[model samples]
Structures are given as C-alpha cells and as structure tokens.
Target: MDLASQIYERKSCRNYLDEEIDLDIIKDFISKCRPLNENINYYYEILTKDEVSVRTPWSAPYYLALYSEEKENYFENIGFVFQQVSLFLQSIGIGSCWVGMASPKKKKSNFVILIAFGKSEKMTRDRSSFKRKDLSKISDYEDERLVPAQLAPSAINSQPWFFKHSKDGFDVYQKKQNILKRQVFKNWNPIDMGIALAHLYVENEETFDFEIKNDFEELKGHTYTGSIKI
Candidate 1:
C-alpha cells in the first residue's frame, strides 16, 4: 500500500506471538532506511531483548530498543528514526507502539517503541476516544480531511500541539501542560515534535517546504513544544 494509506491504516499493535525476528530481517530493514543525517545516524543503534519487562499499555511478547548516545535532541532522533522502522514494520504486516515509558528497566535506551507481530488481532477504538478535531477546528483548509498533523504521535499519545496560520503558511506549537519527564532519555518534546513534523512532511511532501523557526523562547524551556512552517 501507499504511504498515505499506510498512515491511515497503521494502528498501534500491542500483541506479539512467540517468534523471533531474524537478524537479517532487521539488517534489511535498516538498509531500506538510509539515514538523512550521517552524524545522527552514527549515534543511534537498534537493540532487541527477549526477556523485557514492561508495564502499562503494552503486552507484546518481545521488545526492541533503539540506543542513542547523543546528549541533546538524541531522543528526538530516536523518535524520528524509529517512526521509520515502525512504519516499515507495518508495511510488512507487523504492529508497533511508541513504548517509551513502558520499558522502565532499559539501559542506554530512553525511548522504546513496541512492535506486535504474527497474526492480526481484533481492531478496537483507540483509548483516547477523544474526537479528532476537524481540519476546520485545527487547520485553515476548506476541504476537510484528517490533517496528517493530527495523526502525529506524541510522548504518550498526549498530542501536545496547537495550530496558527498565516498568508505564508501554518505553524505548529507545543503546549507545556501536564508534561512527563523521561528517566533515561532527556530532551524528547522537541524531538518528538520533529518526528511529528517528519510525518506531516512525508504525508504532504508536495504541498509545502518545512522550515525550522528560530524561536529562542520555545527552545528555552524544556517543557515547551510545537511546530513551525514547512
């Protein structure tokens, strides 16, 4: 299926069978995802553990962790890189979830994205049941479609973003309400925001060009979050 359809059909998979992904499969997956930045790519590595202990929102059999050593914006790179892996897994009939908080005992891995494999399970409504605000409510478009921005994943699916539009383009900003801190991985709000921006850009590649706004204030507070034009 196409990327747009994959985005729509992709749901967080939290169940896995008693199976192991071959080392070759993992390598092949990475081969497909040539990193955009060489430096950031060098700082990240994918690790897997069979005996992983996880708590809330996850019941998958096995877990995968992407390890990063960068001090700043490393976790964000984790989100950005793993999103690609998760989408690739989905394309190959696998399921995944952003399990950053699920694995509490992980080392050198602050962010954990869960993937559920094997047979497909029953589809259920998302726990949030919160209605997706229409494009009219969150965007400035006359033709209403679920703007891919709404589909961007958050730290815990909190979806912490607000919208502002102008003659040039629209802006996405992060809200600092009820923010949660990561134990091992620091600096994720902006990183996740960047991941969300990547999704929005991939989904709307032809529509606009993404530009990183130099807002010193938003960048100052670690809790503050949001996106700018693209």
Candidate 2:
C-alpha cells in the first residue's frame, strides 16, 4: 500500500496474537529504514515481552526500542524514523503502536520511544474512524496538504501543533502548553512535530522540503518548531 493509504488505514493496536515476528523480516525492514536526519546516531533493539516495563496494563508480544545519542532534534528524529516504520508495518500486515509510556529494563542509550508490534486482528481502521482536529483548526489557512498532518497522532492525542502557510512554505509551531501540561509534554511535543512532518512527507514527498528556521519570530502563544518549503 502507499503511504497515504497507510496513513488513513493505520490504527494503534494494543492487543496482539501469541506470535513472534521473524527476526529476518525485522532486520530486512531495518535495513531499508532511513532516518529523516542522517547526522543523528541511533539504533533499534527488538525486545521480547519479558524485557519491557510498561507503566500501564497493556501487553504485546514484541517491542521495538529506539535508542539515540543525545543531540539536537533527537526525539523528533526518532519520531520521524519510527513513524515511517509504523506505516511500513501497516503496509505489511503487522500491527503497531507508539508506546511512549513503555521503557526498557536496562538503559542502553537515551531511550526515545517504544513501538509495540505483532500480528493482530485489530489492524486497520477506516479514514472516517480517525478522530482528529479539522484542517482549519490546526492550520492558519485552509490547504488540502495539511489534511494528513491534522490526522497525525500525538501523546494523549494532545495535537499540539499549528501551521501558518505562505507562498514560501508552511511555518510549523507547537501550541503553547498550559502550566499543568508543560512538565509532561515539553519533550514529547517536539516528537509530535516530527510525526506530523512524517505525515506531511507521506502526503507530499515529491515536493516537501523541511527546513529548520531559528530566526523566525515565535507566535504569541506558540513555539516554532521548523518550516516546510515546497
């Protein structure tokens, strides 16, 4: 399936069949995987159920742990890379979910995120089934390009992103976090931006150009993440 199709069809799968994915297939997928930022150093480790510690009561037969060296845009890079993997899993009939609350028992590196994946009956969902903000609510102007972004997933479904479009491209920003939610989402929100960018790429890969702009003035209540020039 195409990325756009995967974007519309994919759903978070928490329950899995009692089966283990073939290591060769996982390795093959990893070999083809490319991080959005190639300068960042990262690695992936496949952990069995016994090796993971989940804060909640969810269970999965396998967990994919992403570890990266601390650097600029590390979490965002992980989100971009893993989002691609998530879509790929959906295309290949595997079920996956971004498990932010789960962690490895032993810290090998800076653990960014965990993805739970395996064979599951609950895999895909119709496009109408996705509960997301409308394009107008997420972007400053109406542009069909932002549809996939509006559907991008985030921590607790916070959807902490906003976009302003211009002739040059779109300027991306993170919504201001209130005092109560700041502590929990400060680090996670950037990753959410990366996820949104991944969706944008899936929707417009041929023309999208992602650029980080430090000189752009921050909006009154939002934090600027980057810009996408098409």
Candidate 3:
C-alpha cells in the first residue's frame, strides 16, 4: 500500500503493541519525506518511553520527536512534513498517533511535536467509518479535490482548515478560534493545518505546489496560511 491510499484507512492508532521497528529503515524513510517548505530546517530524534510522558489511550514503543528552526509557518512546515511519516507507517503495517498532549522530559528550544509510533495488528477500515466535516463545510463550494483535506486529522478533531477557490487554484487557511478554543489550540492549530495540506500533497505528489500568499483576500474568520495548486 502507498501513503496516498492509506489516507482513507489511516486512523490515530490507539492499540500499539510492545514491539520495535528497525530504526535504520525508519530513519531512511524519514530522510526522504516530502517537505512542504524545504527552507525550514528540521530534524528528528527517536526517543524511548523513558524520554517522554504521554497522555493517550495507547503507549508507544518509540516517539519521533521533531525539532525545527523557528520561522513563519514553521509549525505548519513540521506538520506538513511529518504527516507523511504517519501515513508511511500505516502503509508498512505499523501504527502511529499524533500526541499533542505529550512532552519530552528534556525539552529543547526547538522541539515541536511528537509522533508516537510502533508495531500493531494490521487493520482495515473504509470511508464510511470516517468522522469528518462534509465537503461543503470545509470550502466555499464542494470540491472533489478537497476530499483528502476533509478527512485529514486535527488535534481533538478540531479540523481547523478552510479552502477558497481561486482563478488558478485555491487558497488554504486556518479557521479562527473563539477565545476559549483559542486558549486550548493556539499552538496546535497551525500544525493541524499543515497535516491537512500534507494529505493533498501525498495524493498529488506530482503537482503539489505550495507558496505563501501576500495579496490574498482576507477571510472573515480565518487566517490565510498559503496558496496551493494541485
């Protein structure tokens, strides 16, 4: 199975087994992950159970800790880049989860987020099982191209993304949050938007073009993230 195909079947795995994967092979795959923004410098560290604390339904054998240089859209850059790792894991019969409620025991200035992954029993699911917003809810109009983003996972199921059609393509935005929701998701929201974009790129690897837009029309309740053509 390919990463693009796994998008429909992939879920936040909560049934990890006590097993180890070949670290060498995993490192190689991570080295080749598509970078939505290559200009942002980033690296990964494989940590064991001893290195971090996780509050989740399942425990993982290893956590892939992402560290990136801070810059505009860096959070989204990490989200866009590492999501491919999650999808790739599922394609190879491993399971993974994005653990926002996790922290490293020895936190560094650049540490961004954790991707908890490990061995699991291979599972199968279909589109009917997806819990997501309707196509119309995510965009001004229904678009088949936006299906991948519709099903993309966000922290606590926030699904904080919106799309607007453009003359050439479309623009992406992070949906604005209220005061209460903002407090809970201020940091995670940009990262979540990146994950949504990753789905579009993974499915359309050949022609995924992402660029910052300065002259974009302002959305009433959303922050412009980027422009996309795919």
Candidate that scores best on TM-score: 3
In model 3, what is the error at residue 139, expressed in angstroms? Answer: 0.5
What TM-score would every model get versus the actual structure? 0.68, 0.94, 0.96
Top model number, lDDT: 3
lDDT of each: 0.52, 0.83, 0.89
Per-residue lDDT over 94-203 for candidate 1, one digit per residue giving the tens place of the 0 to 100 score: 66676655442455543434433432353234535524445564444533333666766565565544556644565555555442444333444555565565566556
Write the candidate numbers in order of decreasing TM-score: 3, 2, 1
Off by over 4 Å in 2: none
Candidate 2 lDDT over 122-211, as tens digits, reads: 998889998888888888877787888888889889998899985698988889899989998877888888898888887777787777
lDDT string for model 3 (107-149, tens) is: 7889889998888775457889989999999999999999999
| lDDT value, candidate 3, whole model | 0.89
RMSD of each: 4.8, 1.5, 1.2
